[model samples]
Target: MSRTTPATLALDRAGVAYELATYDYDPKAERVGLQAADALGAPPGEVLKTLMVKVDGRPACVVLASDREVSMKKLAAALGGKSAEMMKPADAERLTGYRVGGVSPFGQKRAVPTIVDAPAAALPQAYVNGGQRGLQVRLAPADLVRLAGAQVAPVT
Candidate 1:
């Protein structure tokens, strides 16, 4: 599989340090992020799943550990919005310029507000999608927060 992607390019442009990892993506897996963590043999907490959401009807991005689930109520509160919900799969793909399972917070088609779960943000290293299926980038959570301009919150 190709190692270069818009996600990597964005990181490069920002001078963010990260390592690329590739694995066999399982389309049949019920949870993409869990499958990715298993494929990487890493802790579930260190594998972040990028989710596209609409907070108060506005597009937003959320990054949280693969093992956790987002609390929509908490998410809304964090964003100072009234409500939050997952974006439609197709809508998410369209908005982020990536397929459902390959969406990454970086290099999105449009810049949107981003929230990183407090737990994930505390990790010294985390793995996230690399703008494509079967690819992930390992980097410090600090770098991810800084690069994505993500707000850290307990939304999960």
Candidate 2:
């Protein structure tokens, strides 16, 4: 096993149960969620991706299913913001200390408001990036909420 990443470190410190899954990563892949699902033999819906956006000039982390898109209007309404836009890849990397495909809700370089799709709360477990590409962490949704200080909302 390699050294724990920021995401895994947060999970460990929170006493959250999780399984680490690592695989060969292809940088050219277009859809990272689909690739991870295929590699892990899991359903696409069970694998969620973390997206960073600027909500009312502040950073907010949005976690949604790999198969779905974040509803910007709905997210704005839920966040009490007039609008939300996806952060630039460079800004996201700078803010989270993780690259585009490897953004995780926990252990970001800075604490940001986080919102998770309601469906994630219904799942027994979910696989999210482990703070780096080619690695993922399988953990309980409740633990994710607690660790990220995320509110459950309908993000898609």
lDDT by residue (34-59, candidate 1, tens digit) is 99999999988899999999999999
Q: For residues 22-136, what per-residue lDDT tens digits would candidate 2 score against the true structure? A: 8776788899888888888989899988999998888899987888899998888778899999999999999999988888898899998899899976789989889888889
**Candidate 1 — what's its lDDT?**
0.95
All candidates: TM-score: 0.98, 0.96
Q: Which run of 10 residues does model 1 get worst, by summed lDDT?
A: 1-10
Model 1 reaches what TM-score against the true structure? 0.98
Model 2, runs deviating above 4 Å: 1-3
Among the numbered candidates, top TM-score falls to 1
Off by over 4 Å in 1: none
- After superposing all C-alphas onto the true structure, candidate 2 shows an RMSD in angstroms of 1.2
